[model samples]
Each structure stands twice: as structure tokens, then as C-alpha cells.
Target: MTHRIAAFGAALLATTALTVTSLSAETLRWARAAEALTQDPHAQNEGPTTTLNHQIYEPLILRNMAGEMEPALATSWEPSADNPNVWVFQIREGVTFHGGETFDASDVVFSLNRAMSENSNFRELLSGVTEVRATGDYVVEIETEGPNPLLPNNLTNIFMMDEGWSVENGAEEVQDYAGGEDTFSARNSNGTGPYVLTSREADVETVLTLNENYWGIGEFPLDVTEIIFTPIQNPATRLAAFLTGEVDFIQDVPVQDLAQVEAADGIGLGTGPQNRNIFFGLNVGADNLERDNVDGANPFADVRVREAMMIAINREAIQQVVMRGQSDPTGAMLPPPVNGWTEELEQYPEFDLDRARALMEEAGYGDGFSIQLDCPNDRYVNDEAICQAAVGMFAQIGITVNLSALPRAQHFPLIANGETDFYMLGWGVPTYDSEYVFNFLYHTRNDGRGSWNGTNFSNAEMDEMIVSLSSETDLEARNATIAELWEMAEAEMIYLPIHHQVLNWGVSDAWSTLVDADDQVKFKYFELN
Candidate 1:
């Protein structure tokens, strides 16, 4: 690791020297609060990871800055006329990977199959897929369990990998991100996207150069020829880098410093509401939480206790204080942009301290119990501060919250492993549908479904409805099922919905880009001033 870091630094210096002498306008220096977890596309389904991978890997379909579907690797796709259960894609021709491997239907089939593997973090996204096959050189077909109207929507983030290159590097299997396993794919990449990875130092810096032979060279802006990504965890340091012209872009601008950034001379701020909801999850299904003060049973298991905890949180206060009036207090797990979100579903209980206290007593926990809340300090805007506020709110009702604030890398695994009693998580529906949430958070944890459901709240009836949403061709029937699932989750208090995050991106005036509702910055759409 030491040698690799040293080599990466040397390579970056050389690239910087070359850019200083020539092609400076073609270079884009990007920084963020946290770096991508890994380079293996299927290893982690995280925002940073997916944002970084978008430059190197090409998904068959991609959501643009406006959150609308656009064709990329695949020119067009539609359900097969002979079989409604089968979706066919016409893969783009004349595309080549960074390593010179031609892009074709074989790579698509291999990549999707690899994503469905047990260890892949993206397995949940392909839950309804039964089989994938290459029908021709540039044609691929996916057969789901039933007639899935939204099958194409789910493929928006499924990136294509070079089958030959993966096999040659012995990385045919996906990286086991949760298991702490590493492979060559985690540190290397070869794809047909517009950018190629030149050098990478995990959690430090990654360098990319434009693919000279990119198929979309003339079609897209493709102005930025080089990219230097630096992950600076400190907000001050990151903002300073952008203000001082050390970096060209900063994805995550501190919410409190938004005004300062806007007032800065050479820097500009792009602000929008992200399609994500921040929430807290409790181990309600556990017989006895391993990290709670209560002995015989889990207090969170009681519905009244869960409701009491929910009502105790002051969402409006958190939005005004911790978020600096930049967030929208949410009552539902799905954000407004997500389908199946209704005004009634977004109605949360009124903040009633006396009622919460009384409910706690009624649940036979008048004395209140203690529990730990695992939160990620760097993943979301004011994530740690939100947890801190919740600590005090729960304390008002005699509940002692031992706040465990850690970086996202450490905080997320605890929930994935079911080690944390209560935890905080933020969800963004990449597919823009409720099924995306149900597959990962509501379904039973088994066979690649519910991979992130740490609460262990599993119901066979609910699971069946969730699975049926994928193949339910009737629009009316599918929407009704979605509404039913949301009602069930809300009534059970599966999670405490906090608020929807507001995005602020700080960028140099030298270039301009769109602000995606999903908070993903795709440089391909950027243009140099």
C-alpha cells in the first residue's frame, strides 16, 4: 500500500507537470468530502462510488442531470413483442473499452450476471431478473420473472464491464465489500466510458484522462479532457481548495458555508433539493438488542415505544438549526421526487412531548432505556449534528442515547452486519421507484434481497407484495401495491423519517455543469468557459 501511494503521487505530479505546460483548459480538478469506497462497480451501491464510476463505466441507460432517462451504451430498448416478460436492448456499436476491448452484447450479459452474484452489492437491483442472454453481437435480452413494465428503469445504473478484461485479471467475481475482501477490480478499471483511469490512490486522489476515441466525443460536450479527484474530509480544507483555485469543483459544500461560497469571487454555488431522505432505523425485530440497556427484550419491538420515539424528534428544529433552513422535514421514507409518494403519506405526527412521554409510560418503559445510535459523520449534510440533536430529543423522554459517530466507511458496516442497535441511514432511489426502497430495506434478508435491512423486520406477506411490484404489468394494480407497502412500513414504524437533504455544489467559474437531483456530478455534461 505504501509503495502504491508513492507511485500514485509520482504519477500525479508528472501529469500535473504535463498539464501545466499544455492542455490546462482540458483539465478539471474535482474534490469532495469523502472518496469513493472502491473502484469495483458492483462492490458498493453508494452515491460517491456510483458518481466516480460514471466517468469510467457506461450503463446501458443513464439518468441525466434532470433525472430523466437517456440512452448511453444502449441506443434504444423496449419490451419484446413476442414475450412481454423479456426486455431487449440494442447495444451501441463501435465502442471500445480503455484496454481496447470492443463493447458488445457479451460484455453486457457478463456484467449483469456478475451483478446478480451473491457478493455483489447491486444484487438487490436485479432481484426480479431471471436470466440474461446475448441474442446477437449488439443485441441483449433480459427475461424477468414476469412482465416488468419498469425493467428498463432499473438498468439505469447497471454498468457494463469488459468480460475478457475481467476474466484475464481474475476478477470475474464481484468484490465482497462487506466481507473486507479485496481484488484487482477494486483498484483498477476498464470500461467504455468517456474517461479512463490513469492512476488511483484510495481515499487520496484519483486521476483520469479522456478517451481519445470515445464514441460520444462529438455528441457530448466532452470539453474536460482530464480529471483530478481529491477526497478532502475537512470542510474548511475542501472549501479553501475551491476558493483558492486549487480545485475546479467540490460536490459537497458545507450547508452552513453556502453563503460564504456564493459570495466568493471566483467560486459559484449550485443548489437543489436532492432525491434522498435521511432517517433512523431501529432493531425492532430483535428479541434483545445486543447494545441496549434494557435486558429481557428490545423496547423498540413495541409499536407504541417506536411511535413515542418518532414523535419525540423535532424535525422542524433540526431543519432550522442543524440544516440552516436548507432542508425539508420529511415524514415518509420516499422523497417527493419518488413515485408513490402521496401528501397523506408525508403527514407525520405532530411534535407532542407530553404525548410521547405518556406513550412511553403506557408501553411499560416510563423510566426509559438507553441505546446507541450509529451515524456517519461525513456521508450526509449535518449528519453528525442531526444525531446529536436526536440524542438530546430522546433524553427529554428519559431515553439515553449513546451517540456513536464515525465515518461512513466504519458506520455503514455495523448496520450491514446487524451489530448496531439503532442506526441512521440515508436512502436515494436510483430507480426513482418505491420498489428500489423495498428491495433493499423492507424485504426479508435472504438471497440477495434486503441486503441492507439491519432491523430484521421481515414479513412473508409484505415480502411477496414487494416482489410482485416488479412484474405487475397493470399500472393500477402496481400502484396500489406500492401504496399498501408504504402504509405497512409506516404503520410498523420501520424507520424514523427525518428530512430530505438539500444539495449545494461549489464549483469554479471556469466551468459550468448541471445539478442533478440525485446529487451525482457527471463531468461529461460539463462545459469549459
Candidate 2:
């Protein structure tokens, strides 16, 4: 069931092959289900996209594979003594971009400003920021609307771009990803990271070389001299590459095929719980949905209908059948590792087919309505199968769901641009805080926030509460507000929680890595055994 042929290969041919003489132990051949959406660091806030970008582009701060904060482009950050509203960052020195440009404070200020632009998907994480200025060379000051303590946490994925290279290539503005606008930055990259992008062929393969001038040369193991990344969307084909030793490290070892991977020799399977959750979003704010067969109104707009849909979905069944006991079924939007997740929020609603049917009848959807469910085939573990299971569950409540599964590239835009009535999404809290969750999922879809809020649920009162979490310095009060917000979101049933994902990576015994809770693979941290 595991070793099959990939349509694209050399390092991925059907039979056993060696890319650099036994993976070279220096060249790490890696494969995953999805590819980075674009090369523009600030374009997409997705897990796969950010994970790839982390290899080539250096962020001000970084969450290492072990989920600990480590200084990257910036060595240290602290609030300004002169003003609590202003935070000061000491940028790393003697760093050079792949294009041979020197790194400095101006790049941080420029990159931060660019990330706040309208087209930037990361703008929500930088909310409440009023100004960014270069106080001095290697020193930058960020002034917020008020005293902010979690600013450093949000900067982990906010990558720094060379100001001169960006401006010269007309990439000063973030790519309009939802608008389908392509720019030079989307295809090319110049970063101050450990690896340099040598070549790229989207969805096919990409090559990166070791950066001899990397600032962390001596600080890290730096044993991996080169990287070969390929996007093998087909799980069987991907596993085949790994089983045959064509690929050394595969991040997603399919749940159904985990046993087979363990049975193989010279390969190790690493496992852990990831800080992410899968959920379904509904277009509740729209008066009418284009994809649903409902007259003059949105069936999902009714809270009873949402509740009916929620209770009808059996998380236990999904966890056992679809995920193969590789998931933690959840009721809350935020994962357990997050700051605000509680036992009360973790309890999912009881599954009752009769009650679900009654609620549907009470909500005037007794006859039910047909709607298309948008899902990505390659994004999560058995993402399409999970939707398929839900189809049968929804059918029990008199709802007809037509599933449309597409590749991640085409699927994510549908949700971002408000083009889907119902869709599947997975969220990972890099900051491990509820503010990061609410800012993108609960806030109104405007003012550079809620880019991921495909639900169309808008409330001024809720938006104010979401924004307050950014600048509220009091930890006790901020957490209380987060709890209240979670209560409100859960009550509204804006999203149907599925389960938290588990991490399963298969690697060659020549190298080893810690299982990152975020499921991010930083090859720079790899240790040669």
C-alpha cells in the first residue's frame, strides 16, 4: 500500500534512487502534501506556507521546533523605558541576505509596515500598531495604541524582507493573494535565513543550498548542507518515496499507513500532539447564499440550524474512523495548549440524531437544503474523508451536502475572498494565545483584521472586545475578556469544531529532529546521528 510512483521525480522515481549518494546525509529530501502558496513572506498566514518561508526568510523572532522563543533577526526586544506604548527591538547584526544585501533596522521597519498593508494576510497579527520607526541602526521602535506585552509573540512569523530588493522588484506592497495578483516576489526570494532558494518549480519541486554566511552557523548544528523539498499531494505516492529511500524525511506520515512506516527498517517515526485544530466555518451573516438551495434567506443564519449542524456531527466517530485515533476531538476554537482553552470549552455537544432533526424542523429547515462544502484534499490528514463522514452525519438531519474538494492553492482563496458558503479550515496558534485566534476568526472582516473569518459573522461589540485584547496590559483582565469572547463565539456556533491534529513524521535514521507541536520542520535544527 505504500511504495508507489510519483508523476514527478528523479529523486522521486518509482524505483529506489539516490539523489546525493544515500541522501548524502547532508541533503535532506523532504516531501509534504501541500506547497507554499507563494514566495512573498507576508502574503499567506498558512501553516505550509509559513513553514517553507521559515527556511529561507528570517523573522524578527522565531518559535523553534521545540516551541520555545528564540531570537532570530532580532536578538532582543523589550518595552521602551521612556514610553510603555513603544517597544524597542535590537536587530541582529552582520547578517547578509541571499542577494548579498546587508540586514539592518530599516528593513525591520519597512517589513513591519508592509505586513500591515491591506493585501497582507498577516496584518491581523500586527493589529493596534500605530507606527514603526528606525530609532537607530540595528535598533527599531514600534509604537502601539497602548501598552502591549504580547507584541513579541506575534512577531514570530512576521518575516523581515530586504528593503532595497523589495523596492527594486516592485514588491514593496504585499501580493494581493485573494485577488489572484502575481508579482516578482511571489516567484523569487532573497532572505537572510539558513538556506537559500536555489530553484523553484511550484508544486513540482524546490531546491535550497546552505547559506555559508548564515549568522547562526556556529550557534546551530548546521549539518544539513542542502535541502530538496517536493510537494507530493498523493499520500500513497509520498509514502512510496519515503519507503524507497528516495525521500529522507516526510513530514506527514499518513495515519492509515503509520504501521507500515514503523515496520520499515532504517526509518524512524516521530509522534506528538500539534497545537492546531480542524473546524468547519459557515457563512452566517449573508442574507442569501449562492451555493445553497434556500429561498431568500441563509439557512446557516439561524442559530438553531447551526446548533443542529453542530450536534449532528459526531466528533468521536470522526476521531475513530477518519483520523484513526490520531486526533483529539475538540469543542473550542482554540487548541488545549493555547492560553484560554478550558475544560468547559473542551466539552463538545452531545450527539443526538432525533434532537438534531427536531432542531432542524424548528429552524424551518426540516425539509433541509442542499449546499456545497468546500474542502482541500491535500491540506490536512484525510481532510476530504472527514468531510465525507460529515456528509452522512448531516444527511441524518435532513441536510444534503455536496462535497467539492480541490487542491490547497485553489481552495484557500474561496474562503479568503468570501466565495464559499461552507468550508473546512485548520488553525494553529503560533503565539499560543487566544488573542491570535479571535483577532482572525471573530473580528469583523475589515480594517486589516478577520482575513480568515470566512463566517461573515460581524458584531461591532465583538470587534471592540477582540481589539482590546491587543493593548490590555493587565493579564487577569485580558484573560477574562478572552474567556467571555470564547463563550460568545461558542454560543453563536460560528464554527463547528472537529478535532486537534497529531504530528507523525517519518525520517531516515541518518538524521533526527524533535516533533514540533506546530508541525513546522526547521531543517536547521536537524541533528546528524
Which candidate number has the best lDDT?
2
**Which sections of candidate 1 miss by over 4 Å?**
1-24
lDDT of each: 0.86, 0.88
Q: Candidate 2 on 189-276: residue-level lDDT in tens?
A: 9999999999999989999999999999999997889899999989999999999999988889999999998788878777667778
> Residues 243-294, candidate 1, lDDT per residue (tens digit)?
7888888888887888787677766677666778999998889899888888
List where candidate 2 sits over 4 angstroms from the true fold: 1-22
For all the candidates, what are their Cα RMSDs to the real structure?
7.6, 6.0
Error of 1 at 25 (Å): 1.8
Lowest lDDT block of 10, candidate 1: 1-10
Report clash pairs, candidate 1. Answer: none
Question: On a 0 to 1 TM-score scale, where does candidate 1 land against the true structure?
Answer: 0.95
Worst 10-residue lDDT window for candidate 2 reads: 5-14
* Superposed Cα deviation of residue 484, candidate 1 (Å): 1.3
